[model samples]
Structure formats: C-alpha cells, structure tokens
Target: MPHSVTDTTTPASHPTASDTSGRTDALHSVPTGLYIDGVWRESSDASTIAVENPATGRTLLDIASATPTDGAAALDAAVAAADDWARTSPRHRGEILRRAFDLLTERAEHFATLITLEMGKPLAQARGEVAYGAEFFRWYSEESVRIDGRWSTSPDGKSRLMTMRQPVGPTLMITPWNFPLAMGTRKIGPAIAAGCTMVIKPASQTPLTMLALADLMTEVGVPAGVLNVIPTRTSGAVMTPLITDPRLRKLTFTGSTPVGKDLIRQSAEQVLRVSMELGGNAPFLVFEDADIEAAVDGAMLAKMRNMGEACTAANRFLVHQSVADDFAALLAQKMTAERLGAGIDDGVTVGPLIDDKQRRKVAELVTDAVDRGADLTVGGERIDGPGYFYTPTVLTNVQPGSAVLREEIFGPVAPIATFTDDDDAIARANDTEYGLAAYAFTASTARTIKVAESLDFGMIGINQGIISNAAAPFGGMKHSGFGREGGPEGIAEYVETKYIGINPLDATVRNSHTDAR
Candidate 1:
C-alpha cells in the first residue's frame, strides 16, 4: 500500500536534478532501512516509501517501508531485549543517555538539516528544535538515577511499607512529523532513562531525522535491540498486531486525536499503558491591561512557531475589544513581512506544508472562515509556486461559529476575535473540547495568576509565548490526550511502581527460623 512520491500529483515545478542530487547525498549520510535488533536492514518485502521535500514536491529518498512482518520482528527484538535493558543499572543507562546528548549536540547541524529538508520548517527553526530535542536526553540522563520510590512505616505500626520503580517493559513510540526530533527525543529520553526498551515509528513524512538520531544513539552505545526504528506508510497494518501482542507493555503517540483514539482502542485489547499527546486548539488571549508590543511578540511566537504546524500553535486569538483592532493590525503587519520559501533558503521564515493534502486542508479552513463572515485581513490565498506553500494569513472578526475557531488549524493562519472581558475571554477559550495549551498576555500579576488558574489547558504561557521546556511536564487533558512527556514526570510514564508490605512480627519470626536453620 505504500506508494512512491512520484505517484502523487506533481507540483508546478520539480526540484532541479542538481537539487535532487544534493539532497540525495545528504540522505545517504543516514540509514534508510528498518533498524531492528541493533542493525539496519531492508523490510520483509524490501518495499520503499518515498520521502518528499515539501518545499520542492520532489522525492528526497526512499526509506525502507516496513510491513506487518517487519513490525512483528521489531516487537520481537524489543521483547527479547526488555529484561536485560531493565536489569541494566540506572547509572549506566543514564551514562548512555548523557553520551547521546553530547553526540547530538556535536552533530546538531547534521540533524537540523535533515529536519528542515524533510519537515520543511525554516533552517533556524530546525536548529532550535535540535537544541530543544537534545535537552530531553540531557535532562533524562540526570533523571535516570533519580527514579526513586519510598519506604515508610505502616500506620498500624506492625508493618513496614516499601515501594520501588521498575521499567514498564517493551514500548512502542509513535512520533509526529511536525517535530521529528523533539517529539522522539522527548519520548525516547524518558523511556531510556526508565530502562525501557522501545520500537519507534517516526512519521513517514520526516523519518530521516529520527533515523539519524537512532544512528547517534547506537554510536553512543544504546544496547542492540534496546532501540529500533521502523518508518512505515501502512502504520495501522504494521502497528495493530504489535499492539495486540502480550509482550508489548506501553504505547506512546504524538499526533491527531482521531488516530490517537483508534490506537487507544487497539491498545485496550492488551490493556497496554498508553500515553498520547493529541490534537490541540490553543487560544492566545490578549487583555487590555497587557503591554501591546510585548503581547504582539508573544502572539507571533505562539501563532507562528513551526510555521503554525504545531498542535500547541494558537488556533484562536481572543483579544479584548479595546485592543482587538490594534492586535490584529500589528499581527497582520508582522505576518505580511515573513518571507515564504524553501526552509533552506536564507532569511525565509515560512516553508511549505508537509504535503499537498495539508496545504488543501489549510486552504479549506481559510475558505470556510471567510465564507462564514470572517474578515481576511492579510495573506488569504495560496502562492503560485512549485511547493505546497500558503501565504501567512491573518483573519480578524472571525465568527465564533467559524470552522477555524472550532478546529485545530495546523497552518500559518491566525484568526482574531474580540472578547469583552476576562470572563468572556476565558469562556471563548474554553468553549472547545481541547485542553492542550493556552497563552495569555497581561501586565497584571493578579490577572496572570487568575487567568492561568482558570484556563482549561495543560500548559499556560502567562505574558510569554514559548512554554515548552525539557524540564517541564508537557501534556494535556480532555480530548487533547493524557500523560506527561518531559521532566521527572516523563520518566514516570515509562515505569511501574511496586509496593511491598512487611509485617514486623512475621519478619522477626522468619529471621528466627532462618537462624535456627
């Protein structure tokens, strides 16, 4: 079922032969095969999936497309290595993770280039991702040795209570294309730190970055079969059996809500522990008491980071009525100035969507918003070009009923609506079923605390825009999915706790009996 990119409809212009050649050379630096049991090899059928450059609509290279059998093999490898990996000393595991962090930092440019080429984010942004992603390894390296439980005396005074943490066993990690490196590292770092072996399925659209990271991990001495990478186009076919298998203990995914729900359903058969970071419809709220320029900067970062192809990207902008007009104008002016082109190009801030399908979806959302009476303030149409590029867009006076306000618009579009007061802003923001992330800009400390406490989101940015960090617990509630993915809590997701109770009298008797023996 995996088809080549050539089979898809081509864009107005293909990458020049020279361009393709240079990209091909870059691709050659990393493994393109399925990594299993410490070695990279072809899939069962040796079929390949074409990875396309969104900026050029040209084939970058073909990676090994895994089949159901290949998936099973990966699961088997993980199962085989689970016990030994779990038994490995926490300090030793931490050391490996630390080394991985070091190697990733040293090769930051290499991985960043692959991210930009495959995922189409600007090069600078890709570099930023590399830095962000590497932090996970660093943070978890320290967390590994700190995964501790507790010992306590029972309230009855007759027994002692003890607890210990252990790896959850073989895990399956599914990462999204929007953050090829960070998402993977966020999941992998914790899994490694907790001594859990895993098989990762990177998004087919941008598997190269993960593949390169896998290579780096191997070089840094991640045990064979401890980590596996399988990039497959037929994800359901490949993952269903693994999910049903008794050997698999945990499943973690970062993607859309629908797919996450389906995976959760599949996991239910085995009662597997699941951690999902699903879709988000984040809101950016601007209050009248806020500093306008600072609020604008926060809006830009909240709305435009990763070209707005992010689950946490602000989907709705609810500005107070007094500052609504000013916020919209300033945001539009800044958006209009962003240069759109290939991510590799110098000074380009925006890049193409992952594929034509994504571009079409963004266009449809914008059209629906406009048709529903939203004012198209700036950049409304698709660009005339070879790539799947849409103009950075800003829509003011967006109707509450518009699709843009309700749905997660994973594009470079910002829809601004007016709110009368704090209560109104909070109501409008929490109207959706999502609770992933939210942002508010205000100068008042009291307002910031009040709004932060009131927002129905897992993460809140009070007066600041960028909220994600390796040291923070990143996740969501409601339909946005559950389970933390960073910080000390992240490692907890990959661990199981065991409680032990010892009766003092029984222990004393056992000791006497042992002495007699």
Candidate 2:
C-alpha cells in the first residue's frame, strides 16, 4: 500500500454554501505522543508517522507511533487499572461518561476539523459524525448499572440459583480509519461502562480525533489506564502480541471482512472473546409506492456519505422497473450537478479518496465494469489533479455478473439496476455474501414489514435512508460479521455471565417470625 508521496493539490480553495462548513482546519502542525495510562507521552524514541490530508494530499500531522515495547507497556497499564475501574460504582462511571459526552458536544467543531483534515469528509458530515460519536457515550453511560443477574427457583424447592453479568476484563479495541471517532467511541464507551479497561489502537490514517477523545476521557476523571489510546506506526506492535496475550481477554474491531476473520483466527490462541463489525455491501431498494423524489435525495446522501467508505452505506441501487428510468435519470442529474472539491472548499459536494491506491482501485473497478458492458451513466473517471479525486459516478445496465454489481465499490460510484415484484427484489438484495445493512423505500405497510423482515441484512431502514443511530443495534447477518455494536446489546458484549447456587439445609427449616408472616 506504500507509494511515493505526491505534492498536495487543493481540489478547490474557498468554501461555498453547499460545502459543509466549520470542519476544515489548517494542519501544518504535528500532533505527537501516544495517550497511555491517562497521560500523553511519546514512544521510547521520537519516531513519528506522517498523517496526510486526503482532501489535498497535504501532511496534516506527524503522530508518534508506538513500538513493540510501548505497546507492551500500554497493555501492562491497562491490566493494572482494570480492577479499580471495575470496582468503581456504576453511577460514578456513568457520570464520567456523561461528562465526556457533554465535552464532546461542546467541542464538536474542533473534532470535526480534525476529521475533515485527516479523513477528508465534509464539514457538516464531520459534525454529524462527532454528534454520533458522542451519542455512544451518552447511551452506554445510562445502561452501565442496568446490568442485572437473575434468580431462578430450584426444581426441588430447596435451593436457589442466581445469574449475573460481570466485566470481561482488559480489552483491546482496534478501530478503522473510515469513522475514526465514531468507531473508537462505539467500542470503548460500552467497554468502559461495563467496567472493562481497554487499550485502543486507532488507524494511523486518522488518529488525532481519537487522541483528542482520550484527552477528554482523562479530563472527565476517568482513571489512568482505564482507557489507553496508542497511535502506532506499526500495527503489529499492538495487534500481534495483544491478540495472543492471555490477559487481553476481549478483542473488538471495525474493519474489512478479511481483517475481521484474521483477528478471530489469531485470537484463538487464548480463545479471546471477539466482536467484529466488518465489511458490508448494503442494498438500497426502491418500490413502486416509494416517493421517488425523497428516495433519490436520500440515496445521494446515503451513498455519498464518507465518500462511500462506510460498510453500511448503500452500494447496490435496486429500483423497481415501474420507476427505474426516472430514478436513474434523476440520480444521474443530481450527481452531475454536484461540485467536486476539497472537504474544506465551499460548494464542494464530494471529496477525494483516502489515498492514491484507493483511487486507483476505484478506477480499476469502474473500468472493469465498463469493459464488461455496464453503462457508465454519470461518472467513471478520476479528476485530473494532484490529490486522489474521484468524480461522483453513476452506472446503469449493470449486469448481475459485473464486478460493480458483485463487489463493494467503496467509492462514489453508484451502479443501479432494476427489478420487478417484491420477491424478486428481496432475493436480489439478499443474494450478496455481505449483509450488514439494507434500505427499502415504500409506503405500503404490508410490503414495508414484509420486505424489512425478509431482507437478510442486520440493519434495515424502511422508507428512511438514515439507518445507523446510537439507540439501534448496529450489526449485520451472514458474512457481515457477528455481534452487535450499539444500544443495550453493545454494552452487553463486554460482559460475562456467572451463576451462583445456594442450597438450604432442610425444606422449611428455621422459619423465622418475619419469614412466617
């Protein structure tokens, strides 16, 4: 994935009304140091990795990369801090989380700037991401003490059995670069609420926001080592040893399907508990009864979000034959009208790909699809420039066998196809190997419920484009990866169940006055 660094070229210079504002910040300064044991400290040496602004190919910051020794030390600190954090009162823990959430909201603009600089997302989108990230802490904070055990009556009526949920011990949280703040908070917030200390390894591509969040956690009085954010140049320094370590009881990740599987296999050495939110090729289904205008607008917002890097972003556009032509024409028009520019620039509707390699891969996929007979409707070429700029694209007449239809084109290329009838559409939607998220646009109550139930995806939105929220259980079925990452289910992922049994000496023995009454 390594390549020669090219001089950054700004897609555009000024901001426009269409551009998301307040998210961009000048990033000529370096943000160094790994946050370990509640302190911001450097790695053994001043070894640092340069982080680039995907929007313009500019070096945003130089972050300290932890070596193997530093990774080991972070783990040690987390282990040492686990017991005290677990013993802390649930109410107190919840208060700290709430405080962190408040701090994040108050400073949302700052974090959004970091996101725009490091991840190349629009200012508005970055602000929304910060809001979403804060929600995770808010939700889990209240659910922390709600964990409970159950008592069951014994068959013999002489004994009682009790079951309770307990923390899973020190955890290793690895987040992808796509939604840096959101993913890290999704994992660590719930883990902390469940009384588990953690060591977080954020994607080197975007580590500033995560480090900032760690600073906030410490400011809220979160104990040292209760949450450690270690930004490293070499992922193996943290991942390899931690996966095999016995003390690192749980491993949580949000990344590609291949990486998720690899983590699961490697964690088998200690039989570590794992929760993975892997790759998804979500299907955007449109029915005859659906509002065409609303659906089209929603589709653009959903498909283009994060430059289409999200696992839950709609990849396949399944339009009913009744409205296929109109839908495609409208979608193509919307895409064409969009002004492609840097994340910080005004009037910019779409940003560049994360890096040159990603841009090349997207270009290859589009070319392959075109070569295979798919119609390139709106976009199919990389913009002539220095940065990794890809035009917002739309394709039609895409055969089912085409790579565009079969694989996840993790860019702004939206290849649309048509289908007739409910069963056919549902079948086509569920045909893929990945099933993390899906969307259906319809007004028919019966069809809405039926299609939502029938779709093989974990998260489905009916007539609504926004599917992910802190209150909902976010995950997928089949190859999308196992386990949930939001809502009450998310916090439960960090807990272990224990049972206690009690036996009475005799049936009805020693009946006290209070017991008889």
lDDT of each: 0.88, 0.83
- Backbone clashes in candidate 1 total 0
Give candidate 1's TM-score: 0.94
User: For candidate 2, lDDT tens digit of each residue in 114-136?
Assistant: 78778887777888999999999
| lDDT (10s digit) by residue, model 1, range 1-517 | 0011111223222332233224334565778899999999998999988888887777777789999999999999999999999999989999999999999999888888789888989889999999999999999999999999898877655689999999999999999999999999999999999999999999999998999999899999998999999999999899998999999999999999999999999999999999999999999999998888898889889888888999989999999999999888998899988888778766778888888898889999999999999999998778665677888899988987899999998999999999998898999999999999999988889998889889889999898889999999999989999999998789889999999997777543234555795
Assess candidate 2 and give its TM-score to the true structure: 0.93
- The global Cα lDDT (0 to 1) of model 2 is 0.83
Per-prediction count of colliding residue pairs?
0, 4
**Regions of model 1 farther than 4 Å from truth:** 1-24, 506-517
